[model samples]
Target: MTTAAITEETKAGDANGATAREGRGDLLDQVSASPRPRVSASSSPSPSSPPRAEEIAVRVVGLVKRYADGTEANRGIDLEVGRGEIVSILGANGAGKTTFLRQLTTELRPTAGRVEVFGVDADREPRRAKGMMGVAPQEAGLFESLTVREHFELFARLKGLAKREARAAAAEVMCGLDLVREARRRVGALSGGQRRRILVGLALLGRPPLLVLDEPTTGLDPDSRRAVWQVIRRAVAAGATAILSTHYMEEAERLSDRVAVIAGGRLAAIGTLEELFARLDKTYRVTWRDEFGAERSNLFGTFAEARAFVARESLSEFSIARVSLEDVYFALAGRRLTDAGGAAGGTNVTGAAGAAGETRKEGAR
Candidate 1:
């Protein structure tokens, strides 16, 4: 499908950019020393109209990342994320999801292309650009010697909060993530899920205008995962834009205003779930075990068509279900979201809005 056809742009007004003198490793340290910058403003009002460049929270054009060994992790990706929206990047492991995020956060410099965060050139002014965002990497080291409350308060302070403000922000974040009870517990003493929550909490500390999270809920249980989801929703609700990369189909389906699929180090498809679903010709999926007990699957436009096929094949064991985001990934990326192998090329389905129109749900702005 043409990327332009599925890509959604929401215009925003304007946001002030900051200037800092530190690198990624010293981001927090610099924040602690420098004054906090003002948060970015609101998003565009209408989806149908074109947005001004300033309305976009994140703008990436021709973004490319090549390692020293000549490995191209990202290849000319272009995307625009509006303010006050949550966009999820989905892909199989090593499909360049993290690579794309790293470049966006200025953690890794792109070999080519430009990145703008709230109208600031991240590549040229990494510190200033980073000041407008809060990031949660796929893996981050925490202070094991510090208590949970200490971690939050200290990070909040590092984000330019005053001692009193830092304490209050810490309390609010802990309470929101259900980590209040573990407030006094040492980081090394907490469970893995609890530690994960702490990482998310750190990003939410200063309520930065933009959040860049890499699998924020990877190791959490159902309840804890939902807690993080709520926290994200609250952040967006309060006017912050979020961009996250996740392996969970449900997370992408439920949390994102727009879902982007990365395959072979490139954006393969992107749109609302309905927009992506409409790209497919069939609405139902049929799966069954064959004579050798191996599984087989097919898509059908109607239930009757699927049933008829089963009867014709004389298959005794089969099941039919509705097509979902997972199917969309496979159809557009030519592989499952969980696959580790390279993409094999995509199905014939291309472009958006094929058939599923009535079921389309307007994404929350």
Candidate 2:
């Protein structure tokens, strides 16, 4: 589809008045009374025994994307998202997160792969696959002249809701995303953050079984981010599945049932936080400053080793804490979550998390 046409199709939607906590009848119920698809297993099964087609909300195998310039944006990517689950994709710029999602959404054709959504072959039947999904691309435009309510109602109708049903869905989304107060305001008058929320609300219009959000919380402040999180959680609770890509570590840590780390155009690791942490030999991290005052960090196999190193070094300013998803990302992607810089504050230890019970001196490998 042309850019203009795509925008018109997805441009308009709702925004919450204050927060999703506004207590309007459960947004899900007001939007769709039908039951959400459910999987017999709560999560995707091990790769050795993949979940049945019906139990899978989304499935991709050997997904590859190559541009005409000979750049392979996505290479051999494979993933499975179970129904009623939330999966977060993490990666730095150019890591192919967007490329991967675009292929899944069928906006970009893959060089080689199979993508299925709820048992439908997306590669073969893009329309049928898209009908079962609510997609919020990383970037989409909203109509400047349209009011918030108009955006929501019109999009709901376009998604096949009747006039009355569209109006109800619009109101529910407006209140749920804190856009009620701006119901009549033109999209041109809204702030960027508010505009972003409106885009999110658009995806929630018909309550499609799958929600694909690419950095839905990109520009919002903390509270707004949390509000969006709540909205997504409610949607999932009501039986929708969500797959989102985000740069925020905390978002991935708190919002996802499973996290997939995309590095160098491939999926480097995929698992729960605990499962990822267990992959690290160094479970504890110590942060301190060298005599030169440059920040230094070291990973240890155990808390005892971390504490001992601090005491042995006669350090008065130091902290020892459990490694986090940030560490995991560093281990897998070789970059920090906050920026496209080398891992935070020192030599990257994700690959070599210090020898067991050994404390290396500052900058010493």
Candidate 3:
């Protein structure tokens, strides 16, 4: 299938680019900081778009991280997450997503670029940065030395809660996470889901304004997954802003106010689901049975502009519907979302083009 026929991802194909060339030799975390020039706001900020005026919770501007081993992880990607919004960082492996997450939480300092968490320069004021944010990594980071109550106690202390207040805060967290029953259980003995719950519980201890989760449900069963979603919703209701990196498309769809699709360490698209779909021209799906006992389905950009087509062709099997986020993902990426058919590092980024080819190739079979 032609790339355009399958996905709606637009790119200016130069797959092999300068960033990829520079970041070829460092350890995963040791990737060199991006060497790109910085981004400048207009002397007069655009009040119409009002990016600066808006209470943006997280702003990533021209982020580039190039490892010393010559592996470039991020390449001039720009992103903005508004206050109280849930944004999804959607990408395949090595898409610079984890790096983005690390930088925001002050876990990995950016080699270059500015990360403003709650309107502060994080690099210049890391303590201030860490103080206002909560992080739930893919792997839980609780201490094996502590019991559930102790784990909560430790995190509350980290948030600067006094002894009595910390205890009170811990109690609230345990109640919110439905972990009161396991308050005395050692964290080391908790199951994976329980562990994730604690991770989230730790982040929510102080009702932080910003919450960052790195694949918060990596090993969870369906039920546990829903349980975590509940916790996230409660956090948002408490006026928190969240940015989560996830490969699970369904999770992204359900939790995100907008989704940012990243490829080759650059953003392919960023918008609400409907806004992204609008990038596609309206189209129709036509299906019918052939004389040879086969079913044929095809997509068209137009319905032959017929007023009576729907009435005339009462084919019950064919229904009019809008494309889903999955369809939009396929259209933009030019491949099946589930078609991860390669080795451990097998992913969809095929080149280092400064910019990928910028055409949504109409791909229909």
Per-residue accuracy of model 2 over 257-305 as CA lDDT, tens digit each: 7888887788888876555655555666677666777666776666688
Best by TM-score: 2
Error of 2 at 348 (Å): 3.6
The whole-model lDDT of each prediction reads 0.74, 0.75, 0.64
Model 2: pairs clashing at backbone N, Cα or C within 3 Å: 15-179, 16-177, 16-178, 16-179, 17-178, 17-179, 18-178
C-alpha RMSD values across all candidates: 13.7, 12.1, 13.4
Assess candidate 3 and give its lDDT: 0.64
- Whole-structure CA lDDT of model 1: 0.74
lDDT per residue, candidate 1, 1-365, as tens digits? 21111111121211211112112113222322332232211111112222367779999999999999999999888888988878899988889999999999999999999999999999999999988988998999899989999999999989999999999999999998999999999999999999999999999998999999999999999889878887887888788999999989877766777888888888887766555665655656566655656555666666576667666767677666665567667666656566547433222232242232112111122
After superposition, which runs of candidate 1 have C-alpha atoms over 4 Å from their true positions?
1-51, 342-365
Order the candidates by TM-score, highest first — what do you get? 2, 1, 3
